[model samples]
Target: MIRFENIDLAYQGNNVFSDFSLEIAQGEKVVLLGKSGLGKSSLFSLILGFVQPQNGKVFFNENRVDERIVWNVRQKVAFIDQEISIGDYSVSEWLTFVSGIKANHSLSFGGKRLKELMDFFELSRDILNKDISDLSGGEKQRVAIIVSVLLERDVFLLDEVTSALDENLKKKTAEFFVERKDWTVVSISHDPVWLKNPWVKVFDLEKKTWK
Candidate 1:
């Protein structure tokens, strides 16, 4: 559902990507793999329209990604950055605030779903009453992931989401995403937990191509 055709990107005078191209079909789980400074995050930025390509084009569900279509793209995709900060609001307050947003108003993430996700992620129910800023790094990562899933977006852009998580939690998170047959996931991770799954397609930024 996402396609990048001969994309070229640069920062200042340095080139980050040159004639890079990729296509991800619906319900596919793709993991971006490479060392640091290989523009893995920039690929996500390009898809989200946070950064525009100097050449070529990006398309989401057949629509070209540009100023006019970027909003629509954002609505369908849920992005979780490597560093997550959701202000200092309590977990309950934060979730309530997100539910109040116009775009998310139609969706219901009642107590049942919340509890289910928390249980699956091995998070304590007491965390719901804790302030976001007071939570540990791993807790914050799980909370961010839970919030993203609650959005009910079919497409996910996960950037180093399991970086702060332990090995077991990391494996659980990767399995959760890879097992979803109806979701399109593009994850950038250096952890080996994501590599154990044979169904996930691997894209190496070092080679500038997919395997």
Candidate 2:
């Protein structure tokens, strides 16, 4: 569970969240709905312990979320940002390198699991050998989505991850998340089509009140 108790977050000189509060129960799929740069992703940073709130406490279960426990927090969360860079390697090499990261050393990599995921996402097997940099924006986004899933995180922090994908792929990705009961997904998206899922609980970020 993730809980924010009267949290206040600010950056530079602007106040994003002021005395805001909410709790994500054990396995809730919540969506933070707002235009770009409306403090949506910033909330994810707070939940992930990547950024500290100016005031109030962030808690994951019984433990307080802070910089000290961020690595541990990250172990259970996977983030797929809109602008992703898998670096200048072939898709297969990127997958291999990503799986080599300390956090993912225990997981199966670039093998049958990846092939299955790629198939589910409707990506071609040939993409594994293609240059990662040469992939289109939508393709890159899908690759990032696949990588996040490979980590087997219980929570997903998706920041416009499907912004570049076409209608069909977007629906597929949304459906994928809907099927995962263990997933506590907090997503930021401008695409209305993604909101058709029954379990998606939306938070209106543009609202004036912090409560």
Candidate 3:
């Protein structure tokens, strides 16, 4: 349930988007595809209110994404960045800390759910006790993904989420999101694992449109 109406964005002296428009229906899985510097990530920033558009508007679930409603929009959307950073806290401590936040207090993050996600992601339960900084890149990626899943948000903005994972894990990650017909997912990735999924609609930024 996201819509961008004739959006125009610029960075420094360069143009990122010019009269760009797109609409993602509820429960739709759309993948952003293009070479670097095409403003794929900027699209997400526009929707999340991290960057302001010079023209037009962005709407989430019919509400305009502005200062007043941006926080609410963020609370309902799970954003997973390519570089996973959880500070230096141990995994368990980090998860506990985030779960205690006022925004996420209502969601359940019990041991069963934690273990289940770890298993599904091919991660070991022991990782929960490891320091986040000590984990490998791939391990950190899975951990970040686990946090997103535990939040139970219906909308996801995944930016190169599977960049560090092997082929099998990448496929599993793509399948995990694509299979959720009730969830709205907008992902940025170059990995063929996601491109091969029939349910995912590809939006080529080079062409400035969706296929």
TM-score: the better of candidates 1 and 2: 1
lDDT of 1 by residue, 1-211 (tens): 9999999999997898889889999999999999988898998899899999999999999999999999989889999998887887998889999899888998876678989999999998899899999999999999999999999999999999999999899999999999999999999996787766898999888986677
lDDT per residue as tens, model 3, 74-180:
89999988777768899989989989999999988867888889999999878888999999888998989999989999999999999989889999999999999
TM-score of each: 0.96, 0.92, 0.97
Model 3 TM-score, 2 decimals: 0.97
Off by over 4 Å in 3: none
Question: lDDT for model 3, on a 0 to 1 scale?
Answer: 0.91
Give candidate 1 regions above 4 Å deviation: none
Screening candidate 1 with a backbone cut-off below 3 angstroms (N, C-alpha, C), the clashing residue pairs are none
Candidate 2 C-alpha lDDT tens digits along 28-86: 87777877677888888887777899999988865798777777888888888768875
Q: Give the TM-score (vs. native) of candidate 2.
A: 0.92
Q: How many backbone clashes does candidate 3 have?
A: 0
- Lowest lDDT 10-residue stretch of candidate 3: 79-88
Query: Where in model 2 is the C-alpha error above 4 Å?
Result: 208-211
